[model samples]
Target: MLIVTTLIACILAVLFIRLSFGVIRLRRQYRVGLGSGGVDDLERAIRAQANFAEYVPIALILMACLELNGAPLWLIAILGIAFVAGRLIHAKGINQPPPHFSNRVIGMKFTITTLIVLVVFNLAWLLLQLWK
Candidate 1:
């Protein structure tokens, strides 16, 4: 279980680093130090990166807790994979030169679906324990 969580963490960390690279590249390209310099492209890149950073931690924490609480391995793996896939899809969509319509929608769809599943499963599992 720990291995599962750690592996996902590593994968997510790689994604995070990749996003960071995008930020760094854009910052250098635009010659801006701290802000997006009123650049929509840069802003989108930053948001794409920031969005990933925002969502992944909660997802990972929930996943780890679910694992620690003895959630089924298959469920954890499925959700973990789905979440990562969603993030990857989202990053690609948002970082594209222009709006990437389908992938963007699908990416967010995957993300929302995964979150709902994880939350429902965790809550139900916890309540089952309490009921027991």
Candidate 2:
């Protein structure tokens, strides 16, 4: 749980750094009034933050529950790392130009992986308890 917590903190840190870069770019893009990417960047940043806030808490809660239900700590750590990596990939994808959607593809992979990990952990816990 502690490792997961730490990893989540790291994800937040990484997100902040990436968000700062985006914001800076947005500011420059809108220096005169508002350019094409300016509003898009602002919207993207806001939506990204909101989306992170919405999903991350639930992910953390699920991870914590798994821990409480006797899931291996190492598994939790791995999932946490996956979540962070997915977000990093997502950020990269968002920042890149067209045809370079690597970040988005990676982000989706990570997100799906994290979700699967959480589901499997919960289901395993349920089966273990039932068998006991």
* Winning candidate number (lDDT): 1
What lDDT does each candidate get?
0.89, 0.70
Candidate 2 lDDT, 1-132, residue by residue in tens: 356656676766677666766666776767523334546656565455555656666677788788778777888888888887787677666655442466678787897789787988898897998899
In order of appearance, the predictions have TM-scores of: 0.94, 0.72
**10 residues in a row with least lDDT, candidate 2:** 32-41
lDDT of 2 at 93: 66
Q: What is the C-alpha RMSD of each candidate to the true structure, in Å?
A: 1.2, 3.5
Report the lDDT of model 2 for residue 10: 71
- Candidate 1 lDDT over 7-87, as tens digits, reads 988999999998999888989999989879998888888999898988898898888888988888888999999999999
Q: Model 1 segments beyond 4 Å from truth? A: none
lDDT score, candidate 1, position 23: 89
Candidate 2 residue pairs in backbone clash: 93-103
